[model samples]
Structure formats: structure tokens, C-alpha cells
Target chain A: MKGVTVLQSGGSNQMELADLSVPESGQDDLLIKVHSAAVNRTDIMTREGKAGYAVNPILGVEVAGTVVEAAGSGSFSAGDRVMGLVNGGGYAEYAVMPANRAMKIPDSISSAEAAAIPEVFLTAYQTLFWIGKLQKQEAVLIHAGASGVGTAAIQLAKQLSDAKVIVTAGSRRKLDFCRELGADILINYKEQSFDEEVLKATDGRGTDLILDFIGADYWDKNLASIKHEGRWVLIGVLGGSELSKVNLMPIMSKYIQLTGTLLTPRSDSYKAELSKDFAEVVTPYLEQGKIRPVVDSTFPVEKVHEAHQHMEDNQNIGKIILNIASAEA
Target chain B: MKGVTVLQSGGSNQMELADLSVPESGQDDLLIKVHSAAVNRTDIMTREGKAGYAVNPILGVEVAGTVVEAAGSGSFSAGDRVMGLVNGGGYAEYAVMPANRAMKIPDSISSAEAAAIPEVFLTAYQTLFWIGKLQKQEAVLIHAGASGVGTAAIQLAKQLSDAKVIVTAGSRRKLDFCRELGADILINYKEQSFDEEVLKATDGRGTDLILDFIGADYWDKNLASIKHEGRWVLIGVLGGSELSKVNLMPIMSKYIQLTGTLLTPRSDSYKAELSKDFAEVVTPYLEQGKIRPVVDSTFPVEKVHEAHQHMEDNQNIGKIILNIASAEA
Candidate 1:
């Protein structure tokens, strides 16, 4: 099987497409023929040698594909459509996924869109609902609003929950896109101070929750922009990781909560729970057209580097996809 | 009316047993004849010229008293026993307390014990349950194990939830006292590293939640000791307010929460809700003999200076109370 792998040789790891033996299904797994895969900063950071990611060299965390074989007895079978979290093998043509992680893809949605939904939507779901405990009439501020998870958070927080969605982006173009995704307030972070804008927008009450990607620079601002007993959920640190001089007095003084999480590397049990939650609470919104995956760009699987480069440059406003199949296939 | 007042006439504040006009109660307030009072670190901080306290010349936060005059239309009568949180006036012989913050004292409890219940217990309850979201079977790490709030938290965490309780104290004696108060794990922070102790106790899974008062000193250790997706609820910052570095990477990496709070300055409406929660959930535990207030010593009301000195010297194992009357009455 032709697979996308980052060879673990020397100083820094980089990807190399090679022919490796396709993975076999575990007792409760699904052997999937990959249709599409999406890019994440986790892939980049793992490639950069920060974390000890899954030993396998494949760089993708999200995928959609056809279940060519079922591990044990389950609803999915040969030719049955599915989408879910994948191992490092997501960038490959064939990958074995935990059956519990895979949810049946709705017939109406395309494979590329389905692939984009899992990682970003699940991250947004976990941050907004599980960690933030967002309630009706509350408000949320999504930093890096143009990114996949940020865009997904905007849609989910706005459509699914009654939260007033505020988004911050580097450019007006991305701001406009986030506005289209139902952002109640948009801030061009490059031109304006997001802290002041957020405070102004909230009438100094601050948002109920903040979804942050830029870590230290935005940490205090997020704190300042949070309402009393508010939540600050961190899923990524694009700007930098060194959060020097964290003054915790503000958080305690206001009864705030600051949480950082990675949906990747979660236990299989937790992944199963997220998959079920997605199928029950989120998928209907997608199927009914109330919410949809936001795809920024698509590239053939061979151009995975370009997709990564595109996302790394901070140019993409949504999920970047790798088309595993030929254009006409 | 004779009252215990701390006067901030200049750079330094002085505690004085002075005469002041008696307070009149509103429709929803009670004229409490102060029988006992408990001093908190907040009062000490205010007396020592710390900024941001709500009221001036106020000495105490928790009060236990008889209803000498029932100006309100509530349950308390002229001779009914009660205790409640105060906005600052608990040091006086007579004070006007919000009816909601006052609760009937159990027959088994004394005025000193009742006085000790409001500030420390409520702070512990609010941080552990409401903010930290501590649940049954989880693990909690509390700093300052011998302090009033710390001992209260240990007892409550053990009694209310099935969580494993861990505490860090300055000495072996204090650590032993915390163990006596139902702490599952005790760390003498002076003898060894509390972080290492926490890791050792939890099988390296770290704690599910942390109740922290040592602000800047325990910042990184708190980050290191909490499990993934855990919460760190802050109530006070005795060590210092400003941290030299605010590294948010660990916060994001482990999904930990860092927040601090001041319970006394909270609005009346919010306090009412907290009082309701205490009445429903915590009050029953007290009556059921599962939890009790830890009182260190009681001093005469005229000895406000001595009580403040005891708290400042950090000599109390639990709460220090001011007694309005002796055994002779």
C-alpha cells in the first residue's frame, strides 16, 4: 500500500511517501480505503519533534474512507461509508481505524467534507461543551477564527448552543468568512487589540468562554475578556508555547477556569464517546444543512506538503484537505 | 455601640476597640448580637494596606451570634441561634447581616464552630465543587493543608465526594493534622517536594483538581501535578500576586485551569445562591456528623489585636475565633 510517512531518521522528521504493508484490522477495527485526509498543527508539531506522537510516521489525524473490511461483527461492512479519527496511517491509501471511532458517514455529505469534520468538530465540541460547559445565553470568543477548529467552534457555538459567537482573525477576508459562519462579532486582530474589542463588545462584562490558539500573548487578554466565572479553553499554541509570567490572581479573583486540551492521543474509550456524541448531537446539524464543514483548499495526496505549507503559512481560513483519489475517480 | 475597628489613617492600619453608632437592619437583614467572630487572611491583608478590599475599617468575615433584634421578616427570632457570612461588620458586638447569609446553628455546634463555618467552608465548597467541578472518585490536591480553608476542604472533600484527598503543608505536624482531617495523602512541603509527593500518591496520573492558595510559588508545580483536563481553582494568593513568567504551555498541554477568587466581595445575589447551595448540600453533611468545623482557639472580643497577630504569625492549625463572652457569661 502506498502510504504517507515521516521517516524517523536524524535531527528533524520529514514526510516521505513510500510503499509499506497495509495495516490489518484488530478485533474491533475497520480497515478503511482512504478517500481524503485533513491537516492539523499537531501533524506539524509532531513532524517538528516536540511531542512523542504515535510511533507511525503518517502525518494526518483526520480521515474519511470506505470500510473494505470489518474487524469483528459490526454494522459497517465492505463498501459501507464511514468517517472518524485515524491513526498516523490517515495519509495512506489504506488504514485500520478503531471501529468505535468510526461513525457511518451520511450519504448526503462528500468524503472530503466528512474527513474535515472529525478532528476540528470534535475539538470544538470538546472545548465548547465538555471543557467550557457552554450554556444558553452565554458568549464565546474564538481566537484564530479562520482555522478549522476555530471555524467549527463558531458554527457549533452559534447554531447548536445559544452562545453569542465572537471571532478574531488576522485579516478582513478571514473575518468576513467567519462572519458568514455566523460570527456575531468579528475582530481583525492584526489591526485592532482583540482585548479591547472583546471588552467593548461585551460592555466590559467579557465573554463567557474563550477558545484560544495563540497562547501566552493572548492568555492575559483572554483572562481580561472573560466574564466572571468564565472559561478559557486552549487547544493550540501557534504563536509560541512559553507562557511566561502567568498571574493567576485574576483568574481566582473572577472565579474563572482556564483549560488546555488535545483531542488527539485521547484514550480509545473517550474517542468512542466523542464519536457517539458527534453522531447524536452534531451529525444531524450537518445532515440537515444547519452546519457544514468549512474547506479552505484541496490538494491531491501527493501535494500533502503544499497543504501543510498552506496551513503553516496561516493563509487558509478553514480545513485543508488532501484528495487521496484521482480527480476523476 | 462598641465595635472592633481597624483604622487606616496613614500608611499603616491600626486595629482599635472603639465606639461607633449601632447599625440598623433593613427588611432583609438581621441585627446580630455578635457572640463569636472568625478572622480571615483577607482582613489581615486589608489591615496591612492591601488594595481591593470591599469595606474599610472592617476586621472579620465570619460571625456567630444570637438574634437580639429581628428587623427582617424571616425565620430568626429574638433569641434564635445563627451564624452567617458578613460584608465586614462581624467584629462589632452587634452587626446587620443579610438574612440569606445567616443559617441556623446546629445544637451540637458552638458559637466559635459556627463562626468558623462560613468563610473557610464556603470558600472550600465554592472552589472544590462549583468551580473545580470535583466529583466522586476523583483526586484533589489542596495547598496549605493546616490553614482554615485547607482543613475545611480536606474534611468536605472527604465527606461530600468520594475523591482521594491530598494536602501540602509547611511542617510534619501540620501534615499529620491534615491526615487526621481525612487527607488521604499528606506532604510536608518543607521536607520534600509536594509535586513529587502528589505524583507518588496518584500513581503519576496527578490530581483531578487542585485547590491552591500559594499563587506564584506553586504555579509550575500545580501545572505539573494536575492530570489532563483537570482544574486548578484559586481562592487566595498569599505567596504573591504577580508572577515573573506566565508560561501557558503547560496549562494548554495538560488542559489545566488556573484561577483565583475573593469570596467576600461577591454580590449579595450571588452569595444568596451560594448560601442556598450550602444550606442544601453542605448543611446536611454537618448535621449528619460527617463534617465539623476546625477551631484552633477563641479569644475575647477585646483581643482583636491578638487574633490578628495569631493569624499573621500563621500559628493556628485551623480557625481562630473571637469570643464575645467567657464561661461566666
Candidate 2:
């Protein structure tokens, strides 16, 4: 199997394409012949040696592929098209994961599109419904409106409930993209304070839920923009990690809830449960063309380095995918 | 009617007993002839002019009394013994509150005993069941074990679920009281780090739920002592609220949730609903004598100042009550 291996260079991550043995499939696992994989910010950090990774690390976290082999009594069969989140070993010709983590993709969705679904969609679905508990007619504020998870969260919040979805992006182009995806209010965070804008948009009541990626920079603002009994779900700390002497008085007064979560590092059973629930709820919407993938661009597997660069540059509006298989499959 | 009034002296609170007119009962209200009232820490703050209160503040929050007048079509009749949480005016000879806020007290309970039930028990019930969602076989850590809310939480957590209850208190006596109320592990926080003790008690996995009233002082330690997906419910900031540049990385990695709540300042309907729920779940335990009030001492209404001083000095083990009516009555 041909795959990308991370090499350390003066404490920096360097990627190399090399030949490696195929990973083994365990009982109750499916051996997937990966067709497409996606590049995420975490991948860039892992590659740069900033985020921790194991020895002989495989870089990709999400894959859309076909099951080449299935353990008996598994939910999937050989040759079934699937998309899923893998703990690791995704940026390769084949990857093996527990059968429950994989979801069958409909023929209507392309492999590249399916590859974009797993991490972003699952994270969005879990954050809004499972973590945020977004109710109908409640409002949600999603930061980084143009990012993969943010875009997916906006669409999910819109389609799943009658929620007023607000978004904050750095550019007008990203704001416009978010508007097309059903964002009710788009604030150019670079030009204006999102907290003030959110207050204005919601008539001073503030948002019922917030999806935050920028931690330290938005910590106080996020607190200020949340309504009574609202939830502030922290997904990423892109800006920084240290929060300075935060007064929890408002939290008590407003009865706010702050929770932090990640999709990776979860148990196989936990991932499987969320995956099953997501497939049941979102599959019909995907098949009916109500919700679709937002693939920013695609790169050949040989161009894996460039895929990491693309996400690092923060230019992509949605998922940046790596085409593992040849164009003709 | 006679009621306690807060006098401001050099920006500090001074208590005085004064003559006042009885409060009016609305169409859906109950006019209670007060028998006994409980002194909570919040009352001390409101009395000291530390916690914000409205003009002409009345101190008491919880009370047991007889229904002197029930508005037409209300739930209670004249002379019915009841106990409830009043937003204010519990210090007066008569207090008027909505009918639903008051619950009929059983004959097995004394007026002072019933007076101790509303605020602390309701807070404990709401925190453990409603916020923490404590399940069977889970573990809970209740800080300030001998305090009114802590004592109630210890009892409720033990009676409601088969949970292993751990407590952190300042003294041997407090720890003993907690143990009698069914604490599996007791850590004298004054002698050692609760986080380390909690880890040891839970075999390094940590507690599933934490009922915290001590804020900033226990903030980091509380984070360290929680298990994966554990909930830390904050009710007060007795220790302090100034948390300096705290790192939120652990919250993300452990998938922890931190929520802040207060029983006061809630809408009438919301409080009524929770009151109803508490009555439904804990009434059986109360009837079976599985749960009982831990009243520390009683002070006549004229000696209300001493009651406040007792709670302020943290000298009481459980709830301190003010007997408003004659002992024979």
C-alpha cells in the first residue's frame, strides 16, 4: 500500500510518500479501500508536530471508501460504499475500522463528497443536537462560518430545527457563502465585534447556543452573547488556550452551561452510537438533496502536502479532500 | 406585622426589627401566617448589603407556616400547614406567595424541620437530578459537606440513586455528619487536597458528578477530580470567583461540562415547575422517613440577628431556623 508517513525535521512535521504494509482488519471491523480522504486543521498540527501523534503516524482522520473485506456478522458487506471517521491510518490505500463507525453512502453522493461528510458532519450534528441540545425556534451562533465544521453546523441547525442561525467569518466572501447555506445573520468578525453583532441580531437577548472555535479571543465575547440558560459549546481553541481571570458571576446569573468535546479520542462504542444516530437523522436529507456537501477542492494523494498547505492557509471554504484512488477508480 | 429590615451603615448591612403591613395575596397566591423560617447564606449577604437586593430588603428565603388565607380556587385552605421558598418576606409575620410554591407538610415534620427543607433540599434535588442527571452506580462529590445544601445533596444523591457519594468538608465533625447521611468517602479538605483524595477514592477514575458551592478555590481541583464526560454543577462562589488565567485544555480533553445555576431569580412558573417535580420525587422518601431535615438550632424572630450571625460564622452543622410564632401555637 502507498501512504503518507510523517517525518520529524527540527521539531517540524515533514510528510513523505512511501510504500507500507496494509493494516489488518479485526473481528467486527471492515477493511476499506479508501477512495478519498479529507485534510483538517488537526492534520496540519499533527503533521507539524504541534498536536501529539503516535510513532509512524498516518495523517488523515476522515475517509470515504468501499469495504474490500468485512468480518462476518458485520453491518457492512464487501464492496459497500462507506464514509467514516478513523482514529488514524486514513491517508492510505486501505484503512480498517470497526463496522459500526462506518456509514453506507448513497450512490447519489460522490466519493469525494462522502469523504467530506464524516468529520465535519458528525461533529456538527453531535455539537448541535447532542452537545448543544438546540431546540426549535432557539438561536445558534457559529464562529468560523466558512470552516468545514462551521458550514456543516449552519446547515444542520437550519434543517433540523427552526433555529435562527448566526455566523461570524473574516471575509465577505465567506459571509456570502454562509448566507447561501441558510445563515440568518453573518457578521464580519474582522470588521466588527461578533458579540455586539449577535446582540443586535437577537434583539439583545443573545444566542441560545454558540459553536466556538476561537477560545481565548472569543471567551468573554461568547459569554456576553449567550442568553439565560444558554450553552456555549467549545469545539476548538484556535486562537489560544489561556483564559484570564474570568468572572463566573454572569454564568450563575444567566444559568449558562459550558462544555468541551471532541469526536476523536472517543471510545469505539461512543463513536458507533453517534455515527448510527447521525446516519439515521441526516441520510434522508442527503438523499432528498436537502443537505449537500461543501467540498472546497480536491488534490491527488501524491499532493497530500499541498492539501495540508491549503488548510493551513485557511483559504478553503469547506473540506479540502485528498483523492486517494485514481480518477477512474 | 413585624419584619426584619436591612439598614446600611458605612456600606455594610445592619439588621433591625420593625413594624410592617402584611403583604397582599394575589388571585393565585396564598397568605401564610409564618411559623418558622430558615436562615441561608444568601440572606446573610443580602443583610450585609454584599449581594445585591432591592430597596427595603426583607431577609428570609424559606419558611414553614399555616395558610391564613387561600385565594379563591387555590390549592390550600385556611390552617393547612405548608412549607415553601419565598423570594422575600419570609421574615415577616405573614408572607404572600403563589399557591404552587408552597407544599403541604406532613404531620411527622415540625415547623422548624419543614422550614429547613425548601431552599437546600430543592437546590440539592435540582442539581443532582435535573442538572447532573446522576444515574445508578455513578459517583458524586459534594463539596462543603456540612452546609445546608451540601447536607441535603448528600441525602438526595444517596436516596435517589445507587451512587457512591464522596464529600469534602473542613472538619472531623462535618465529615462525621456527612458520613451519617451516607457518604462513602470523606476528605477533610483542610488537611489535604480534595482532588488527590477524590482520585484515590475513585481508584483514579474520578467522580461522575460534582455538586460545588465553593468556586475559584476549587475550580482547578474540581476539574482535576472529574471523570470523562463528568458534570461539575456550580451553585455558589463562597470561596471566591476570581479564577486567574485558567487553562481550559483539560475540559476539552476530558469532555467535561461546567454549568452554573441559582434557584433564586427564576420565573414564577419555572420555580413552580421544579417545586412540583421535587415534591413528586422526594415526597415518598420524606413520608417513609428516608430523608429528614437536619435542623441545627432555633432562634425566636426577635433574635433574627443572632440567627444571621450564626450562619455568617459558619458555626452551624445544618439549617438554622427562626421561630416566628409562639412555641405553643
Candidate 3:
């Protein structure tokens, strides 16, 4: 298998395409012939030596592929097109996906689009619906609205429920893209304060749920923008991590719940459950053309460094995809 | 009717015994001839002009007494003994309690004990079980374990589930009292660091749930002592409210949930539901003599100032009760 592997000799370095043996599919796993993979900050951080490196460190965590082999007793069969969470081997020709995590990708979307859906879409779904407990007629404020998860959250939240969706983005273009994705209210955070806008928009009640990716920079504002008994789900810390000062009094007085969540380190069974839920809820929406994957750009697997650099520079508005298969294939 | 009232002419002054007319019971309320009242920090703060002032502000929030009058459609009848949460007027000889908030007191406990149970016990019950979502066999760390809510939480958590209860207290006496109440691990915070003790006691996994009142003082330590996906329930801010510098990365990495909760200011129906749950869960324990009220000291209603002074001084081990009537009554 040709895959993206990090060179362990260097302190901080680039990912390289190298030949590797195909992984054995576990009893409850599917051997996927990966068509495409998605570039995420985790991959960049791991490559940069910021996050801990894994043994035999392969880069991508999200993939769209077809099952080449299925373990006995698993639901998936050979030649079935699937996309979902992968255990670090996604930037490869072959990857092992837990049977529970893989869901059939509808024929309506392309393989690169399917690759973009797993990590970002599932993250948006789990954070908004499962952890944030967004309800109909309630309001949600999603930070980083132009990013992959942000775009996915806006679409999923808008289509799946009657909740009012408000979004904050850095640039006007991203805000515009979020607006196209059905965000009810938009805040160009570079222009104005989101907390004030949120308060003013909601008649001082603040949003019922908040999905924040920028941790310390937006921590106080997120707290201010949350309603009494509101939920602020933290999925990423792109802005920063050290919170200067957070007055916990409001959290108690207003009954606010600040939850920190991540999709990467969850159990395989949990991912499978989320996969089942994602298929049941969002699959039909995809099939009906109510939601579409927002692909920013695609690169051949050999250009994995460029994809990581693009995401690092915050140049991509949506998912940056890596086409694993060769043009001739 | 005679009641304890704060003199509002001056800024944050004193409590005084005042003569007042009995309040009329609402359609769904019970007019009770108060036998006992519980002195709480909220009452002290209100009297000190720290919280807020109400029209004819009374100093008590919990009471146990005999029903003098029942509204047109209430379960209570004249002469029925009841204990319940009250908005105000609990310090009065006659207090009005919502029928839903009031529950019949068992014959085993005294009126003072019943009065001590409402605010503190209900706060403990709601914080530990409802907001904290404590599960069986999980570990919980309770701060201020000698205070009213702490004592109640320890007792209730012990009787209801098989959860391990770890407690932190300021003094040796308080730690001893907590141990007597079935606290498995006791950290004398005055002598050693609670975070170190908690980490050691939990075997580095930390506690599953934390009921915290020492806000800013324990903010950082609380974050350090929480397990992955643990819940930190904040009910009070006795130490301070301003958190200096908190590293939110731990919260994100550990998936910690920090919730700010309060029993006061909740809707009547919400309180009623909590009241019903409290009664259903803990009432049997009280009846079976498995749990008993830990009353620190009882002050005569006229000496309400002294009780407030004692609580403000942080000298009491458990609930400070105000005896509204003598034994002859």
C-alpha cells in the first residue's frame, strides 16, 4: 500500500508518500480501498510535532473508499462504497475501518465529497444534536462558520431541526458562504463583537446552544452569548487554549453547561453508534439533495503537504480533499 | 405575625425582629404557622445587600411548620405538618408555601431538622443527581464537605447509590464529621492540596462528578481533578467568582463539563419536581433512620443576627437552624 507516512528522524517535518503493507481487517472491520481522504488540523499538528506521534504514524483520519474485503459476519460486503472515520491510515490506498464506523455513501455524491463528510459532518452532528442538545425553536451560535465543521453544522442544523442558526466567520466571503448554507444570522467577527450581536439578535436571551472551535479567544464571548441553561460545546481550540480568566459565577447563576468534546479519540463502538445516527438522519437529506458537501479543493495524495499547508494558512473555506488514486487508475 | 426582617434604610446592615400581618395563601398555597426556619447564606447575602432586596425582604428561605390554612385546592389541611422551600416570609410566624413544594414531614424528625433539609438538602440532591448526573459506582468529589449542602450530599449520595464519595474540608473537625457521614476519602484542604490528594485517591483517573462551591479558589484544581468526560457542578461561589487564569485545553482534552446550577430562582414547577424527587429518594432514608439531619446549632428566631454572624464567620459544621417556637408550642 502506498500511503502518507511521517519521517520520524526529524523534529518537525513533511509527510511523504511511501510503500507500506496493507493492514489486516479486524473481525469487525472492513478493508477499504480508499478513494479520497480529508486534510484536518490534527494531521498538520501531528506532522508539526505538536501533538503526540503514533506508532507507524499515518496521516489522515477521514476517508471515502470502497470495501475490498469484509470480515465475516459484518454488514458490509466487498465492492460497497463507504465513507467514515479511519484510524490514521486514511491517506493510503488501503485503510481498515471499523464495521460500525463505515456507512454507505450515496451515489449522489462523489468520492472526494464523501471523504469530506465523515470527520466534519459527524463532529457537527454529535456536537450539535448529541452533546449540545439543540431543540426546535431554540437558537444556536456556531463559531468558525466557514470552516468544514462549521459549514457542515450550519447545513445539518438548518435542515434537521427548526432551531435558529447564527454563525460567526472571519471574512465576508466565509460569512457569505455560511449564509448560502442557511445560517439565519451572520456575524463577521472581524467587523463586530459576536456577543453583542447575539444578545441584540436574541432580545438579550442569548443563543440556547453554542458550537465553538476557537477556545480562549471566544471563551468569554461564548459565555456571554449563551442563554440561561444554554450549552457551549467546545470542539477545537484553533484560536488559543489558555483562558485568561473565566468567571464561573455566570455558569452557575445561569445554569450554563460548558462541554469540551472531540471525535478522534472516541471508542470504535461509540463512533459506530454516531455513524448509525448520521446515516439515519443525514443520509436521507443527502439523497434528497437537501444538503451538499462543500469541497474547497482536491489534491493528489502525493501533495499531502500542500493540503496541510492550505489548512494551516486557513486558506480553505471548506474541506480540502486528497485524491488517493492515481489519474490513470 | 413576627418575622426576621432586614432593615433596608441603610446600605447592607442588619436583621431585626419585626411585627407583620400574615400573608394570604394563594390558590395553590399552604399557610403554615412556622415552627422552625433554616438560616442560609442567601438570606445573609440578601440582608447584607450583596444579592438583592425584595419588597419587605425576609431573611429565611426554608421552613417547617404546621398548616394554619389551605387554599381552595391544595393537599394540605389545617394542622398538617409540612416542610418546604419558600421564596421569602419563611422567617415569619406564618409563612406561605406552594402546595407542590411542601411535603409532609415524618414523625421521627423535629421541625428544626425538617427545616434544615429543604434548601441545603434539595441543593445537594439537585446538584449531585440531576445536574451532575452521578451514576452508580462512579466517584464524586464534594467540596466544603462540612457545610449544609455538603453534609446532605454525602448522606444522600451514600444512601442512594454505590458511588465513592470523596470530600474536602477546611478543618480536622469538619473532616471527621464528613468521615462519619461515609466520606470514603477525606482531604483536609487546610493542611494539604486537594488536587494532589484527589489525583492520588482516584488513581490518576480523577473523579466522575464534582460538586463545587469554592469557585475561584478551586477552579484550576477542579479542572485538574476531573476525569475524562467528568461533570463539575458549581452551586456556590463562597471563596470568590473571578477565576485568575484557567487552562481550557484540559477541559477540551478531558471532555470535562462545567455546569453552574442554583436551586433558587427556579420555577415553581421545577422546584416541585425536584421536591418530589428529593422526597421520593431521601425521605425513605430519613424514615428508616439511615440518615439524620446534622444541625450545628439552633438559634431563637429573635437571635437571627447571631446565626447570620456565625455562618458568615464560617464556624458551623452543618446547618444552622433558627428555632421559631419553644417546646411548649
Each model's fraction of native contacts: 0.88, 0.84, 0.93
**Model 2 misplaced stretches (Cα beyond 4 Å):** A9-13, A53-56, A327-329, B9-13, B53-56, B326-329
| Evaluation by lDDT, superior candidate among 1 and 2 | 2
How well is each residue in B1-329 modelled by candidate 2, as lDDT tens digits? 88877767322137777778888888888999999999887777676666675333677888899999997835789999999988788888898768887888988999999999999999998899989899987999999989999989888988889689999999999999999999899999989999999999899999999998989889989999999999999899988888886887888888999999988667778779989999988888898889989999999978877787788788798999999885234
**Number of the candidate with higher TM-score, 1 or 2:** 2
Residue-wise C-alpha lDDT for candidate 1, range B63-174, written one tens digit per residue:
8988988875567788988888878877887888888777889888888899989888888988888777889979999999999999999998998897899998888889
TM-score of each model, in listed order: 0.94, 0.96, 0.96
Clashing pairs in 2: none
Q: Judged by DockQ cut-offs, is candidate 2 incorrect, acceptable, medium or high?
A: high
Give the distance in Å from residue B112's predicted Cα in candidate 3 to where it truly belongs: 1.2
After superposition, which runs of candidate 1 have C-alpha atoms over 4 Å from their true positions? A8-13, A327-329, B9-13, B280-290, B325-329
| Residue A264 lDDT (model 3) | 83
How far out, in Å, is residue A172 in model 2? 0.3
lDDT of 2 by residue, A1-39 (tens): 888877773221378877888999888888999999998
Provide backbone clash counts, one per model: 17, 0, 2
In model 1, the Cα lDDT at residue A303 comes to 75
